[model samples]
Target: MSTLTRARRKLRAHPVAADAALAAGVLACMVAGSFAEPHGPEGIDWGVRTPDVLSLVLMTLAAAALAFRRRAPRTVLAVASGASVVESVTGDPRAPVAMCAVIALYTVAATTDRPTTWRIGLLTTTVLTGASMAAGPLPWYAQENLAIFAWTGIGATAGDAVRSRRAFVQAIRERAERAERTREEEARRRVAEERLRIARDLHDVVAHHIALVNVQAGVAAHVMDKRPDQAKEALAHVREASRSALGELRATVGLLRQSGDPEAPTEPAPGLDRLDELAGTFRSAGLPVEVARGDEGAGLPAAVDLAAYRIVQEALTNVRKHAGADARAEVSVVRVGPRIEITVLDDGAGQDQDHAPGGGHGLLGMRERVTALGGTLTTGPRYGGGFRVHAILPVTTRTSGARDGRP
Candidate 1:
């Protein structure tokens, strides 16, 4: 920083030192003004007469009181005002001691409220002006008496204005800071929602396609020599599933791409309308999947549709991966009075069927999607020999998105 700026900061940091310097300046001005005679024979003349000992003593006391103006403004004002009143009554020329009182009044006004400023300011002006008019060597209507009134009023007015400006700037700074905090919170919320949506998309895509690829690759390996044609068909299914997995992964990850990068696929998100195709993929992979729909002609919101599709896909993927070689899966969708209910069950007696699948994200992803849509899910071991997954989704979501209210 520059020299002047550094000096101002130091002065503000040590206000009493700054006030002492101000007191010294006021003392110099008072001593100098006491020597001047405005009504001299040749206009205003300097060094016409020196102040009396009593005037000098009062001037010194008034200036010294100003050194503590900021520490105790009202007390300093009272001291300075008393000294100026004594000088106005006792000194012949009234050595400009009221200047210190004016400075003290300004300090009082700046540090206090408007009502206090007005009360203290008016009282100081009246006492000093009345003392000079009624008891001084000068006449009651002299300009010196009126000047005390004008100067004190100016000090009070200027100090109040400065206080008002300081308050205004502080208020604006607080408002901007509050707005900045709100923007940061909103941005973080949006980021969290987007992350959840991407996670759900990735889980659904990988769980469904990887399960199919794993099944097909195992079949191709088991029958490679005995049934070459069947093995080749299984390899072809593996290729298709792999390709589908890549496409879905690209679409989900593309959400994080920068603006200048290649655009992601514009294919609409899967919904219950694609239930037959979803089931066919599992059926071809050696699992029997039966899908029944009771909401054939019902229209569903986009978020609800996507969430429903993901729930079914995850549930079936779990069944295929954990529900042994002879597993049979069934899915049902029904619309009932402002809600869409989905149920997926499997008659698989696989050992892993009783436990969580894929580190538990499958079930958790399904639950997150359902909860985001103001829905409920129930998943547990079946009564006899299988596992059951059921979810109820709102036809119209409370929020605006499928995964946590982000479009």
Candidate 2:
């Protein structure tokens, strides 16, 4: 940086030193100006003409008071004004002793509010001008009295302008900082939402297929010795379930890969269009799931379709895991007015094992999905002897794309 720029930064960093330097500069200027002759051989001469000892003393005291202007601006202004009044009355040769008072008034104006600046500025101008006119050796129309009025007014105006510019710059800086913080908070919120979405997708994919695999594996083991042929078919079903699970898992994990990696699977997300396939897998596991639809061929939004399919899938998985071996599940999809309703009922023998560990999380995830689309889901044990899951989803949901399905 330039030398001037570095010096300015240093002065700003050390305010007390900056103030002391200002006081010394002002004192030097006042002392030099004090010797200029008020009237000499030439018209308005500028030659040195020393004032009385008292005038010199008052000028020194006024300049010294400016050193602490920022610490006590009002007090410094008062001291400087008092010294100028004394010099105006006593000095035979008036020596610009009021210059220090002008500097003091500027300091007070910059530090105080505008109302206070006006009050002090007017008071200083009136008292100094009145004293110089009434009691000094010069007449009322003397140029020195006019100079005091002009200088004090300039000081107040310049100082007030400086204060306004500083306040404006500070406000701009605070606004920029607030905007940066808001952007950071918004970014964090979006990342958290994405993480939750990935987690829900993983759970739905794993839980549905894993439950079927568990069932088929059990069946294969039970009939392995007595009926080898039946055992072979059950093992085949287990293999198919596992393969489907792996495919879905790969698709889900593919979403996490970097953009430069291999392309993600082109297969579409599972929706109500895959209802038959989902039901067939459960039937293969010997759950005897029956599906009935009355959606009237109405197109559903992408989010609603996906959410409806996952809800049914998770409900059926719960049935297979908790319901007794003789359980029979019935799934229904219906359209009523502007809403699509889904219900899954099971005629399983009621058992305490229905409420399994981590079971609440599955229901909670389902509820989150439905609620996001402004829908509702209700799942609980039926009055007689089984579990029931009922969901009401809006047919005309606000989605980013149109999904081909009758939810």
Give each model's whole-structure lDDT: 0.89, 0.86
- Residue pairs whose backbone atoms clash in candidate 2: 35-49
lDDT tens digits by residue: candidate 2, 289-347: 99999985778877888999999999998888888889999999999998999999998
Pairing residues by index, what is the TM-score of model 2? 0.90
User: In model 2, how large is the Cα lDDT of residue 179?
Assistant: 91
- How much lDDT does candidate 2 score? 0.86
RMSD of each: 3.9, 3.3
With a 3 Å backbone cut-off (N, CA, C), the pairs that clash in candidate 1 are none
lDDT of 1 by residue, 130-241 (tens): 9999999899999999999999999999999888998999999999999999999999999999998898899899879988999999999999999999999999999999
TM-score of each: 0.85, 0.90
Q: Which candidate wins on lDDT?
A: 1
